[model samples]
Target chain A: MNTTSWLNPLAALVLSPLLPGIINRTKAFFAGRRGQPLLQGYYDIAKLLHKGAVYSRTTSWIFRAGPVVGLAAVLMALVLLPLGGSAAPLNFTGDIILLAYLLGLMRFFTVIAALDTGSAFEGMGASREVQFSVLTEPALLLSLAAMGKAGQIGSGSRIEHLDNFLSLSGIYSNLSASVWMRNGTILLLVAGALLIVLLAESPRIPVDDPNTHLELTMIHEVMVLDHGGPDFAMILYGAALKLWVFSALLAGVLIPVRSAYWWLDAGAVIGGIFLLAVVIGVIESSMARLRLLRVPQLLTGAGVLSILAFALILWR
Target chain B: MTGLTGSDVQGHLAVAVSPLRSVVLISGILLVLIALLAVMRSRLLAGRKVELSGTWDCGYARPTARMQYTASSFAQPLTNMFGVLLQTHRSLERPEGFFPTQAGLHTETGDIFRRNVYRPIFQSVERLLLWLHWLQQGRVQIYILYIAVTMLILLIWNL
Candidate 1:
């Protein structure tokens, strides 16, 4: 647990920015172009932090406080999540619900702050973000529930607790049996749902285009248009941390390797992060962002997939 | 008048003493008392006015209600998009072509919850339960038949 405490924040601080860089590099390499350095994001963040921010004339205190709350909420989620095969720092009976709600709180504030700028472009982006989120959240929760049920902690166990040693071993043991085909099926379905959620949550392709300059279609980027300097850096770091946390969760479910050696789990966790980044990069390179009208359909498809997984679990 | 026998008087009293009759009588009295109170209170307060004549030094001026904004203008854009759902209506008088005169526009939107959502859902439920409507057709003969059937079933089971 003490190791988990030290490693949780350390991993978030050290590896958060690298995930985005890896994704970009993977995409560049796949496209046959020389990629940016792994440390490029770190340097960019440092430069941003050294500069000053310019406030928008139309914004209120919410605009200034938005990034701060966003960063804090993401960090809090990190503390609630287990880095590898270790328990989180703050484990409670129902911590996973709190974890998801904290992220929701961050999203709510971020959207409101965007709207406070009174820019129609930002408002449009905010509206789309909220609509997509409303469809995406159920998938996230249901998928996590399926994964939890497969581990035999189905009744009321928090998702964050699934990272513990006993729970990890239980999940692996159940997967090895033919009688638990339902469990395996649900696990695979959840992985698929989570893959979609990863795209939706991080503003990746097929849901949002982070690299797009067109203000009318941008979701996450348009919301941060008025932010600069340290505030912008905070937003970037917060997004990176969220990506790392989610990827780590996906890794915890997919990777069944258990070891008493902390370094081994840490290595697996890092490898999982790298693998997720590559997967995301491949997806972005392969597909275009969904049309604005069709994005809802994609999100709803994810929700239905998760519900199917849940129904399979219940049937079993 | 002939003196009533003790047995006849007891049978009449038993018929009059019923829980349902008491409940109906009490509720009827309470309803009348509430209506009377409401009428008397309104009459007593109708002519009363609060004097604000010297409270302000501003010159006397009567205030009109036209300064307020109407709900229609506030919800114009929303009403336009969902006019079918809301059952909105509009009436307008426009100026004549080439030579303009007085012009005005009026619009109103109905609540979709009543017209579209609730009424349709309820109608579908009613259709589904159409058979149950025959059970309560407001016919005395049908009600008497139902009661007779119920009592006969009870008697057969007891036997």
Candidate 2:
């Protein structure tokens, strides 16, 4: 458990930037173009950190606190998450709920900061972000609940108990009924929902275009328009950390190889992370940014699918 | 004790009826007074005859309501921009060329909260709970009829 706990944050920090890089590389490979270095994001963050930050005259203290709080929240959630089926350092009842709420808190502050700029473009982005999250939240929780229930895990249990592959396999094997069948179905459903959520939340392609300079069509990027220097670095790192944590969680649920061997589990987790990034890159490279009006339909479809998962669990 | 109980029931009934009876009586008297005053004022005005003359059109004989700006026209541009989210429906009819027989336009926008948020959720829930739809149809009417029947039963028992 301690080995897993130590490895989780270390892995999150090391692999966070690489995930985006890998996605871009995958997309580039598909297009038959030379891809950027895997460490390109690291270089970008270093450049941003060295540069001086420009403060917006229209902004208040919240703009300053937004990145700090955002980074802190994601780090805290990573601490709560188990890497390769190991319990996190801080495990408590309802910790997963706390993790989700902490992420929500970060988003709440970030959105407020966006609005504080008094930019109509930022305000529009914030409005759409909040509106979409309202629908996304239920799907997220419902899917998690379905997975937990299918595994015969109690809702109030700490996430730490499910950290590594060994424990997951132990729990999976010891169940009186067939847990893997239900777990596999729930995993697929959750993975699908989380895939969409990752795209939306991370401001990836289809839901948002990170590379786009136009603020009007931007989601996450537009919200951070006024941020610079260390603040911008923090936002970038925080987003990467968030993507890493969610991907790790999805990997834990889907991957079956869990033993006392930390190296194997870590490799599986990293491989899962890479696979997720490739999928994201493929999605971004292939799909055009959805019409703003149609984005809600995509989110609603995710919500409907998650609800069906919940209903299936209840019915069974 | 029995005699006192009978008087108490009568007293309670009076307590309920007295305020309503007084309110009706006072309003009836006020209505009559208002009618009488109106009749007296008209008669007094009729007795005094005065004649005055001025330009009926206030020196602008070409004035028309068509020349005035309307509130809807002022808000047309903004409403058009957000038409999708606002669910604004518009219909316009115009005659070709310079001379037009009739030209009219109408616009109606749905409630923002209902169209964007509430209706979608409601539809989702309805789809999830299709069996419960019958229970909600004419629900308010059924509730009112149920209340009326209960009141009638109470009234008969009291009588």
Q: Which candidate gets the maximum TM-score versus the true structure? A: 1
Q: How well is candidate 2 docked (DockQ)?
A: 0.01
**Candidate 2 residue lDDT tens string, A1-316:** 4665678778888879888888889889988999999898899888876665566566777776777767766766676666554556555434556667768977987888877665555666677777677767787777666666555542324435432112222232222223455445655776688777777777787888888877778788878887776678878888888888777766666664566676776677778887888888888888799988788789878888788777776676
TM-score between model 1 and native: 0.65
What is candidate 1's local distance difference test score?
0.70
Residue pairs clashing in model 1 are none
Candidate 1 chain A minimal-lDDT segment of 10 residues = A165-174
| Winning model by lDDT | 1
Candidate 1 residue-wise lDDT, B73-125, digit = tens: 43454455456677777898988888787878877676768786899999999
> Which residue pairs overlap in candidate 2's backbone?
A84-A164, A85-A163, A85-A164, A86-A163, A86-A164, A87-A160, A165-A258, A166-A258
Off by over 4 Å in 2: A153-178, B1-159
User: In model 1, which runs have C-alpha deviations exceeding 4 angstroms?
Assistant: A153-182, B1-159
Candidate 1, residue B25: the lDDT equals 45
